[model samples]
Target: MKRALSLLGYSIVGLTSVALGGCGQSGDAAPEATEVPKDFASSGPSAKAVESQFGTPVKDRVATIGLLNKRNNLTQDLVMKTGESRRVGNVIIKLANCERTLPWENPPEVGAFVQVFVEERASVQEKLAWHKVFSGWLFKDSPSLNTVEHPVYDVWVKDCAMKFPGEEEDPAAYASSSSAAKASGKASTAPAVAPAPSASPSAAPSPAPAAVPAE
Candidate 1:
């Protein structure tokens, strides 16, 4: 009898140990971050067209525009001219690069202008996840110490290509793969939510239905 009781106790301990082991294994395992589209190839020939048109380098993890010398607005304008543009959401972006001559007039600014197109009531808010621009100076001038790089321009280009037709500016067919990912259970990163439109008090509300005339 004593031997039987001891065997029963050992069996219970073994089962409990196995259950705890399984639970620990589950606790250690976590879902990996879903890999959305990273390489520019998914854009198909559209991205390739831009690369060939503007000579944008697609090496490394980012597309490099090389070094640009900021001379004046003229240099900046020249670079802007090289870009093939498209509208993303409410912003218009141009993809181009050039050697800007650092102007000697005022504070002597030397850098590239990754211009972000702003509509009447809209402008670039905070940094959101998207393609970004890469630029730097050739040492003729120095940017303010407080200045930090905002690759929003590149983000704009990729976003625009994915969302809107660059030549036509249609929003529906051209949206980014991120949109499709969101439709699936893949991309969960929420975009910046815009505010709701306000109604004017001058606009009167709809009238209630009149009381029934007949019973």
Candidate 2:
């Protein structure tokens, strides 16, 4: 009976040790689960919705676009020329071309072709990498025409830097023109002042005529 009791005590101690060891191993091996995200891409800009129109050639040739970060609601403006790119956080934006319609054209519009590259992980097993997520023309007036299909970022057109006739002139030019107009108006309204003609001596001629008549 004494031997049997000793054996039972030894068994209980061994089982408790094993249980503690298993719990430690489990804590070390498992991790918090992360939910995989779904793709956020959408088809945008039907052919009929965004018509590409270009009249005046691009002058300065620099394109400007607005970028939005959905996670934090932050927005930034990106300026680039054709074949130029700007990087932010893990995203890259490249410009191809920007265009605008002539002033006379109906329903004025502005558009730009953009390419977006993003750094993302394809899956849990893969490492973070860069990928071209979206590339298309985006319109300033109509943003729904094209969309950047990523979980973190959104891009849209603002306006093309090119200029057209009958459009608003440069601020410097406008100011100069205004100043000149004001000067012209003042000149036209103000009356001209002239010096009066001086009267010359006729006394010598009158004296000669009086002497001749007396002789």
Candidate 3:
């Protein structure tokens, strides 16, 4: 009986040691789960909608131009002519966060196009939602870009007023065959642009062609 009791005590101690060892191992084990960060990308659909209207991604990144301090307009300026400010004007835009590559014409099979995208404040997501309501009014009267936003003209300032209707002009849709892309070769890296005419005030104005094609 004495020998049997001693053996039972030993067995209990051994079992206790094994249990403690397991607890220690479990406490020291590495974590079993991990989290990955979300990837940042340019806005995709908004960018695509704009790309469909405009021939290419004109600017490397989305840009924002403030409206005339006086008129406070939010319009898109996507033209690519010299003396034309490459940044465009008078609107604020936060770039979309995803990018996708689609087939584009080298010689530009489409007619004149306007790069279209929603404009939003740099700090807010909901700003773009409100922007859609008034975006249609970007163009109404032709106000000189300088006269509209100059600090000196602040006396004419107004809030929440839309002064222009978005009357866009598309000439590329009807232009001649010269604008088609090359059928079988590498795509051209060169931009589709025309020579800038000298900005001489005294240059005799040519008669306005009735049906001008878009560049």
Top of the candidates by TM-score = 2
Residue-level lDDT tens digits of model 3 in 123-183: 6554532132121112122223222222311211111111111213433333333445442
Better of 1 and 2 by lDDT: 2
Cα lDDT, all candidates: 0.34, 0.69, 0.30
lDDT of residue 207 for candidate 2: 67
What does the lDDT come to for candidate 3? 0.30
Badly placed stretches (over 4 Å) of model 3 are 1-50, 58-66, 71-133, 136-215
Q: Using lDDT as the measure, what is the rank order of every candidate, best first?
A: 2, 1, 3
- Highest-lDDT candidate: 2
Candidate 1 residues lying further than 4 Å off, grouped into runs, are: 1-81, 99-111, 122-215
**How well does candidate 3 match the true structure in TM-score terms?**
0.17
Instruction: Return the clash pairs for model 2, or none.
Output: none
Candidates, ranked, TM-score: 2, 1, 3
